[model samples]
Target chain A: MILKTNNLCKQYQHKDGLVDALNHVSFEVNEGDFVTITGASGSGKTTLLLSLAGLIHATSGEIRIKDFDVVNASDRKLSDFRRKHIGFVMQSFALIPYLTAIENVMLPLAISKFKKEQKYQKALALLKLVDLENRKNHLPSELSAGQQQRVAIARALVNSPTLILADEPTGNLDPSLSTDILNLLKKINKEEKITILMVTHSPLAAEFGNRKINLHNGCIN
Target chain B: MNIRKLVWLEFKQHKSQLISGLLAITLGIAVIVGIRSISVVSEKAVAVNLDNLGANILVLPQASNVDNYYAADIDAPTMPEEYVDRIVSSNLEGVDNLSPKLTRRVKVGTENVVLTGILPKNEITSKPMWQQSGLLGNDLKASCAPSNAVNQSNGYEDEKLQRKVIDSLGADECLLGSTISRKLKLVDGSSVIILGETFKVSRVLNETGTVDDDRIFIHLHKAQELLKIPNQVSAIEIMGCCNAISDGLLSKLRNVLPDTRITTIGQIVATQIQTNKMMNKVSLIFLIIIIFVGGISIGNFMWANINERRKEIGMLRMIGFNKATIYQMILAKAFVLGIIGGIIGYILGTAAGVWLGPELAGLPVQPIPSLILISLCISIGVSLLGSILPAYLAGRIDPFKNMQEV
Candidate 1:
């Protein structure tokens, strides 16, 4: 398995009471599985994906990635794991505004143990893959929403992670642009055999995945 | 990520913020540097003055019931010759030179002048580096009287000039101070009439930037004879170890010669100390205000930088930068800024300070080490001090909250 969560749980507390975002949610993403997790708003798909990505702590139960027990790992180890093995594609496309497209793509590589020249070469290649090589010098603000998303995708793939977790990756795009992004994700999955776990509310978005799991009231079905 | 690259990225991302931190560091360093330079200048002034003054104790005759110290310039009173013998016999530590000086008030072309007596050999002990400006002391040495106190003195000792009778033992010539020479336009061979006697201006001492710079100097024997005093010397100006003359020695001197008086150089230098203290107070207040203003500018700039970098910090943390890395990044930016500012401020401050020294002293200003040291210290200090707040705020960034904002 590339990522596995056993009996995972997450809670959201309010002044009146507690809300279960994820309740005893158990799931797995095997290597090369392009899994799409679909749910309505507040159905806990985002929460579950966050927990699996190690962005947040699970209230209870275990999350393991590639034979490493992430739940038992230290903060340092988790950070290193995130930097090396996990890439996140946020709904808003978290491209640093100040950095050029290529530089933004090179960030993770910059943080890694890769040599400077190697990182540049890898980032350049990834930018080319996203068709943003010509627009590599453009700032995030200078790029269109679709181009920004492409830069973000290049950034996610620059470190060559085994698992990619994206939340609403194409939710902000038009149907045509959404299709392009979905096709790009599919191409990456087919060529690199990387596991992709995506959470989305759109059934149309879910259709691009190889398998779909529905989340309702914090339970997987 | 390697710390070096991370730090560089952080600096690059937050150039303005880093500049803010740098400004703070640079300013703090500049203040320290500027203060240090002034203190150094004062110290140099002290050295120059001490050199020209030569004798530590300056014995101006006691005025009759005069309370104002600054206005108490009186006629030269004859000191008992016996006290000189006692001071010489008392072998004290650090007692390198003792020479008597007599001040006579004279009018030269409508300008009030003061003529002082000098022993040419005393320059070596007092103004040890006096000959740096190529002023000859040949005639002064030549006209000196051998007081049965030492062996053959060096330099041209002419018998003709020594035989010019004032009260029977006066030297033929006088030396003009640099300022006095400039004021009277007297050259090396110019003749001047003073005290109804014509004396040749044998030499002019270089501008030493002391009271000596303003006076006329003559051989001791010439001063006594021209002033019509015989066998009577002015106050015994002692320049050697002050500690050697104690209460016991003073009492012994009184016992040996009851009519003679004894005073330390400390009493003579009290006015100078007061002036130094006053000037220090004024400079300190002004410099402190300037530094505080600069520090506030830095602090305000750093605070703004911290606020501006909040999102960047959040993003970095989200990307897996730990607390230590964030702190280190901020501090590194601060340090780089400080170093740059320090270098710039130091260069600017030193140039200005040296340029202004001559104007302030009314003479040529030389490069002083303490000034340079002060500037360097200020630059470094400002750099470090400026970083504290920005680094703290950067450290306080909560990645989740910050990243979620935009």
Candidate 2:
């Protein structure tokens, strides 16, 4: 299993009482698998996705990524692991507005100890993969939402991670653009052999994943 | 990207803010440098004048009302002559040379002249002290040879009138200053009747380029006799071996010769110098406040910049930037700003200081180490302080929350 969680549970506490976001959730995904998690609003899909991403910790659970026990990792080690292994794409297409599309795509390589020339070549290749070569110098504000999502995808692939976690990868796109984004993901999985874990509420978006799981009342079924 | 590129990108985006910060720092540094130059120049002026005064100390009798060592009204304190004998035998501490002089105001015709009587040995020994331009010493022969035009000319001849008058008076006469001799038309060896005694003109003395240029010098005993003052002297001039010994020796002289008032030259210069030092301190304090103001301004601007770039930081972290990379980016920006601002501020400040230094000092001034040190310190200090807050703010930006907003 490339990623595994044992009896994972996440609780959000309000002033009144405990709100169970995820309850006794256990899951596993093998190397090279394309998986999609589907759920309604507040149905624990995001909470599960975040817990798997190691961004937020589960209240009671064990998370293991590859051979490393991510649940037991120190904050510093977790940050380092996040930089080295994990790539995340947010629903809002979190491209740095101040940076151009090329720079945004280069962000992951910039952080790692990659050589400058090699990092730039890799970033340019990734941008070309996303068909954003002409729009490399344009900032996020200058790009359409679909273009921004493409830039974010290029950024996510820059680090050459074993697993890519995307939240609502095409939730904001029109039907035609959504299919194009899905086709891009399918191409990346088939050609690059990168594992994909996506969280989405749209059934059509979930159809792109190789396997789809439904989260209902905090339980993945 | 790398820290250098990160800083360069930030600098390009925020050029105007950096320029504004540098402007404030430049103004503060300029003020400090200008004030520092003035104080340095004034000190140099005081040092030059002190050099011209032969020594840095002046010793007068306790009851004498002399303004300075050369003043004519100075009276020898009517104390027992044992005081002089004791001063001579004890080798007064801090005193390199102890020369006693007698000064009297006497009338030469209608003009009032101050007369000074000096012991030949002491006077000749003190010649090295008066070696500034125009003052002649026994060792340095006069440039022109004495002419015999006076002995060969008639009194009635206009060309020879001065020579004839000089011849009428023999040697052992008066050596009139140029101003006095010119006004009286007296030549070398001219005899002048004064106080019922016929005094012959001797070699006319050259100008000392001092107040002494207005006075005449005669044999000490002759001056005492001419003024009809016997056994009584005027002022005592004391030259200290070094400034370190001056204060202690002056106090000792005042103590031993209680009847004689002792004035050290350091005391005279100290009062004004002390005032100048206090003013300098005030200016230094003001400069410190100004530097801090610049620092606070820069700090505020940088902090706001960090806040404005929060979403960008979030995007970087989400894409795979670790905290260390973010830290390096922030710190690199701050360091670049510091170095650039410090160098630019230093250059602008130095230029302004050099241009305005003399105007502030009330005279022309030369650059000194103290001024440069002050400017550099202010520049570096303000730059560091200004950058600290921004660096911290940049570090604290949470990628998750900022990304959520985006």
Candidate 3:
């Protein structure tokens, strides 16, 4: 298994008392599995993704990603784990506004021991893979919605991570651009054999996944 | 792709905010350096003035009530001129320079002008201190040199004569004070009748802004012969050595001359010293105020910057930048701002000091190179200190919380 979570739970203190954002969630995904997580608003899809990526601490859980326990890891160790093993894609295409397309793609390797020329070549190759090689010098604000998302994907793939965790990756795009992004993700999945756990509200996007998981009210249905 | 490059790009993005922070530090350092420079130069000028104006101590006849040294010899009771020999023979350590004078009111063209008799340096029969101290040598020479056409013909050839030390004066020749020379229309090499005796004017003294400006100077023996006070002097002016004066030279002189009235010009030096001390204190107070105000301004700017870049910070964290990295990035930006601000502030402050020193402190100042390092340290220190809390807060920002907002 590439990813595993057993009896995962997340609780939040609200003005109205304890609220369970995630409750005893359990799931598994093999290497190269294109797993799409479908959920309603506040259905714990993003929360589960965040917990798996070690962005958030689960109140209770056994989350083992490739034999490394996410829940038991220190913040620094989790950061290392995320840098080496996980790639995250967000709905807003979180490309730093001031940096160019290639520069944004190179952000993941900033703290790495890799040589500057090596990092640049890697980021350049990723941009080419996303067919944005000609627009490498353009900033995020200069790119269209689809082009920005492509740059985001290139950034996500630059580190050659074991898994990609995408939260509503196409929620901000129109249908045509959504299809293009979905197709690009599907192509990366089949060709590169990189596992992807994507959270989305669209059933059409969910259909692109090889394995599907649906969530409602913080529980699997 | 490195942290430094990332910081540069971010600085470009937030140019306005970063510039504002930079300006705050620059202004604070400028004010500190400018005030300090002026104060330093002013204090030096005062010390030079105190050293240049001679005869801090005066010895007058016991019956005289005169407090002013210049007027101490005018119509004063006479003391034995042998007292100069007594003090010289005593081999006192602090007696740096001495000028004994005898005065009388004499008619010159129907106006009664004060005629003061000063002992010639060659007549002092002891080792002179002027050679060692060069006391009143260069400055006095510069003052006596004719500054305008009206006094251009009043030049003297002897070094001591130009220095106003009067190593030797002819019995028939007299030095005219600036005011007296102008009033009587006298010049060097001109002859004037004083007390029914024809005397040649040797040189016209410079305007000293003192009672001496209105008096005429002649050899002591000549005045004694003319006035018939053959063995007496009105007052003895003493230039006490600086270190000796501080070590109770006045008391020592008083002990030696028990029958004479001795006084010191300590009040003038005391007032200048007090003013210097006050200026130093004011600069210190201003330094504190600038640090407080500048620190707050930079802190506010950083806080606002961190708030605005919350999403970007979270994204960096999500992509694997740890809290430490985030913290370093913020501090690195502040460090760059401080360094640039410091250099620019030093240049600007030095310029301001040069321009304002004369207007504010009545002294012309030069840029002190040592203050550059001090300005840099203060600027960098203030910038870093102000950003510490904000950097910590930025590091603590939860990636998930901020990303969720996006």
- What lDDT is reached at residue A141 by model 3? 95
Q: Please tell me what DockQ candidate 3 reaches.
A: 0.39
Worst 10 contiguous positions by lDDT, candidate 1 chain B: B142-151
Docking class of 3: acceptable
DockQ of each: 0.18, 0.29, 0.39
TM-scores, chain B, all models = 0.51, 0.56, 0.57
In the range B125-209, model 1's lDDT, one tens digit per residue, is: 3343323311222222211111212213332132212211112212667777778888898989898887777888787666655
TM-score of each: 0.65, 0.69, 0.71
Q: Which digits, one per residue and each the tens of the lDDT, describe model 1 over residues A1-221? A: 77788898888888989888889888777899999999878888877776775667778888989988877776667767877887777667877776788888887765567887888889899988989889988999999899998888888887789888888888778989999998999899999888898888888889989989898999887
Residue B178 shift from truth in candidate 3, angstroms = 17
Per-residue C-alpha lDDT of model 2 across residues B220-336, encoded as one tens digit per residue: 556667667666566655544332332366677766677677665555457435745766796779677766887887777677777878777765655556666676776666556
* Model 3, global lDDT: 0.82
Candidate 3 chain B worst ten-residue window by lDDT? B144-153
Best TM-score among the predictions, by candidate number: 3
- Sorted by lDDT (best first), the order is 3, 2, 1
Give the distance in Å from residue B144's predicted Cα in candidate 3 to where it truly belongs. 23
- Candidate 2 global lDDT: 0.66
Segments of candidate 2 deviating more than 4 angstroms? B20-23, B37-39, B46-54, B58-263, B347-361, B364-377, B402-406
